[model samples]
Target: MNNKPLAERIRPEKLEDVFGQEHILGRGRILNRILKSGRITNMIFYGPPGVGKTTVANIIANMTNKRFYKLNATNASVKDVKNIIDELDTLFSVDGVLLYLDEIQNFNKKQQQSLLEFIETGKITLIASTTENPYHYIYKAILSRSTIFEFKLLNKSNIIDGLKRAIKIVESELKDKNIKIDEEALEYIANVSNGDLRKALNALEIAIFSTNLDERGIIHIDLNTAYDCTQKKILNFDKFGDNYYDILSAFQKSIRGSDPDAAIHYLARLIKAGDLISICRRLLVTASEDIGLAYPNAISIVKACVDTALQVGLPEARIPLAEATLLLSTAPKSNSVIKAIDAALYDIETKDIGDIPAYLKDAHYFGASKLGRGIGYKYPHDYDNNYIKQQYLPDNIKDVKYYIPGKNKLEEKIKSYINRLKGSEL
Candidate 1:
């Protein structure tokens, strides 16, 4: 008996009823294969909101004819979850419980970890959904255990199709009221909703309630009214303490996109908000990791700016700070620095992080040269230092080459120097 209207009344109840994600739900899809074969794995549906994640889970439940239960990580707790597991044991004698956990990443590590056995032992077929990227935010062990399916946001055409479905619902619900809505206005609602089908439907519901006259009466629903009705919903980007990520995102995108003006704008925002110190540190890193060698001088200049800011203090230090940002934004960009480290890290992960070659190791200690550790070591000062083919790599990594310098002025010099030093080896 709530005052909510059409969209609420007609939420889809079956898989065939769900829209979008055709690849997953289309004929003979992998997901369909999993379900029809009775081998559906523990899954995590990850993407932006309202692209049929929940509906898919429901379809899974329906296909299996299993007991279905929903828990929101926002409200459910350890005890509550345990209670639900116990309740499933008590109520359902069917194959398994199909547990749909929404916003699963919101649960802390321990809470999430609790679900592992239930998944492993086949106590439940857990389908978790999250808007945030779980790879970054969720615990690793949990992620490794589950199959992940990424869902993308619906595009314009998909949104139009979903809107058409909503229109049918609206027409059905308000049939007795003799009310009508313009297709263009409905399309505007779909556009504003931005691929969130729930958002589009919700906006349609609100617009219906807000309009005093339907198409038969006054035929009114201007772009402003359709827009204002939904856009007024809260999007408060509370610039509280934790806005560091947001600021960093803006800075990274600006520098990567080569918009020096926007980079400066984001810098000003962080600086004004008293997060200048953090901004300065990240920029110091960005100069080397992102703009390194492309503009080798950028790192030293950024370091100088950091020192200047710290030594002289803020109120007046923003001058050098601004200068460093301008140089970094306008300078040539390269990810070679970070890419080198990342590739090295990948090697460490998949292969052994081998030790330095004996030749590369220290020979200064007693009895050291006898072990061939530094027996043939070539001190650059002993000779010309211009072209010395020293064994620098660990035995394991001797033939493994990782770092590829980006095309930049300083790296070109580095390439030439390396070529001269290791002419035969290279």
Candidate 2:
């Protein structure tokens, strides 16, 4: 039996053997065009784990005829990098070097900067792979020198295709024994992998290796055996990673888009990831920012739900979270509140204004009639409807209109009432 792990045992040797990421590696794609031109530039491969970042880097080295050297940034240091740099002057360096740095995000600024000169001068073709966003974690100099390709999560179909390849490799290894994997079992592994090919392959290996052969002299792997190998479905969420932010973004957008299904779907994902705090905070923001004014009561309802969720944490907390998500998603949507506040803030930040109107200025001081304070101020209660058209803004920007009521029923009613008051009393 080969001691190497199944992922390594069946690592794709060629671009055609690689699974997923067709966007980059497919025909006529940018990376594909680069490889076909017989020249590999300095590049950054970024995405989640168990995709084809490292595998494609290896394929590039093999196709380009460049000397391939890999170092994981987690443990590699400046000395290790110097070792590779020293080779650039040797006879073996005639072919050039392709340095594959895995998890390049872990490398500090100085360590990444050490390779700037070599990569800039074409002494080494660097293929830096990171699961984190390269633009955020990688040094700016290194990013400026490389093209970034994002490797997205593999879908279930792509994962199943990879699993089929693994099954063939496993069956070929056991020539004396036949391996029969049920179709349902194959898909079970694919579904539980959460778009990670290597994770699915490992689970499949576990099911095959750990199961006992039936009386038919064949290793029969069923759904039950697959379940045993995969105890829980993979949840691809890092509380501090890009996935967390992406999910939160999608959740809020879904609610704003009035798609309860998508909103609840992302809500469930957040809940499964144990991100109750993010969910609560985002829900409250959505109520005010997205559902404000249209459903003026939504803020109160969502606040109550959030309080309930906090009091009763998950798995029970998902109930009130779901309620809040669905309520905000299905409620009448309006961004008037956020827009109004933001417009006011923009003026405060960028524009100049004159003094406050005397009628609106503080009149409660010791001064009786000094400083033109509270002069000609008509108390609203003294008016017929307890409302009078008055300028509350500074003199310069008093005519600037910031709050444009949304075209919702509540805002429309408020707009009509204000217009009536302006016509009757202005």
Query: Which lDDT value does model 2 have at 6?
Result: 94
- lDDT by residue (tens digit), candidate 2, 1-426: 888999998999888888988898899898889888987899999999999898898888778766789999999999999999999988888888899999999999999999999998898999999988887899999999999999999999999999888888988898888889999999999998988998998998998899888899899999999889986886878887877899999999999999999999999999888888899999999999999999989989999999999998888999999999999999998999999999999998898987888888888888845888899888999988898767889989988888888989998898988889778312
The segments of candidate 2 whose C-alpha lies over 4 angstroms from its true place after superposition are 424-426
RMSD to true structure for each model, in Å: 7.2, 1.6
Task: Give the candidate number with the greatest lDDT.
Answer: 2
State each model's CA lDDT, in order.
Answer: 0.74, 0.90
Per residue, candidate 1 scores C-alpha lDDT tens digits across 293-341 of 7888888888988888878877777788888888888888888888878
Error of 1 at 206 (Å): 1.4
lDDT value, residue 346 of candidate 1: 88
Model 2 weakest lDDT span, ten residues long: 417-426
Clashes of 1: 0
> What is the lDDT for 44 in model 2?
95
Report backbone clashes per prediction.
Answer: 0, 0
